[model samples]
Target: MASDSSFDIVSKIDRQEAENALNQARKEVEQRYDFKGTGASIEWSGDSVLIKANSEERAKAVLDVFQSKVIKRGISLKSLDSADPVASGKEYRIVTTLKEGISSEDAKKVSKLIRDEGPKSVKSQIQGDELRVQSKSRDDLQEVQRMLKAADLDVDLQFINYR
Candidate 1:
């Protein structure tokens, strides 16, 4: 019998790369002429990112710079989920979510999606923040990947650790 080929389903971002990108963005914000006097700042805490600026436009500009840095560092733009700005005195703050791994709900959703829509040769099992999908033929796994990509759900997804 042929051995099953398997791969992990995940949405992992390299935290080190993200931090490096954040540092670069911070430097640009500090040195930029308009931002220098605007009291704008970007900070990351746990899975949340915060941006503060004197105005909503300034905050958006800072977010743009941050997005550019993230792109330069090879991070997917889909990882960010920014919220609308909230007022705080003369400044405004916006919070963004750095989505890394799947939650239990998302894992279950993925598992169900695969079982319902995947090829007959494919099978999937949820494992913590990831799902393991297996097939007797590598072609089935490739097809599964294509199907998932075509679905394009809100959460970022990546295929990894294929064996």
Candidate 2:
């Protein structure tokens, strides 16, 4: 009998790439003519990214630049969650966070999808923030991956550890 083929589904970000993108954004903000006197800046504050500018529009603009850099680094925009600019004492701030891992609800959704629509030989199990999918036929596993990618899920998915 052939052993089952399996792979893991996860939502993950490359932290080093994220840091590089942040650095590039910060450099751009500092050197741009429009941001010269605006005091626009981007940096990490603990685990979150902080964007500060003299005005709300500038802060939002800085966030846009950062987002673009992140995209260039191949990270999904869905992984970055940013809030509306809020006025502080002397600056407008936009706080952004990197979201990783599939939530239980999202996992459940994926699990349900596999059960309902995937090949009958496939089975999926939720393993905390990730899911393991197994199938007797490797082609069926690939089909499931295609279906998940085409799904309009809120989280970004990555397939890993194929075996």
What would the per-residue lDDT of candidate 2 be over residues 76-116, giving only the tens digit for each residue? Answer: 99999998899989899999999999999999999999999
What number of clashing residue pairs does each candidate have, in the order they appear? Answer: 0, 0
What are the clashing pairs of model 2?
A: none
- TM-score of every model? 0.90, 0.96
lDDT of each: 0.89, 0.95
Q: Candidate 2 — which residues are off by over 4 angstroms?
A: none
Candidate 2 global TM-score: 0.96
**Over the stretch 22-135, how does candidate 1's per-residue lDDT look in tens digits?**
999989999999997898999886678889999999999999999999999999898888889888999999898888888889788878878889889899988888889999
What is the alpha-carbon RMSD of candidate 1 to the true structure? 1.7
Instruction: Kindly state the number of residue pairs that clash in model 2.
Output: 0
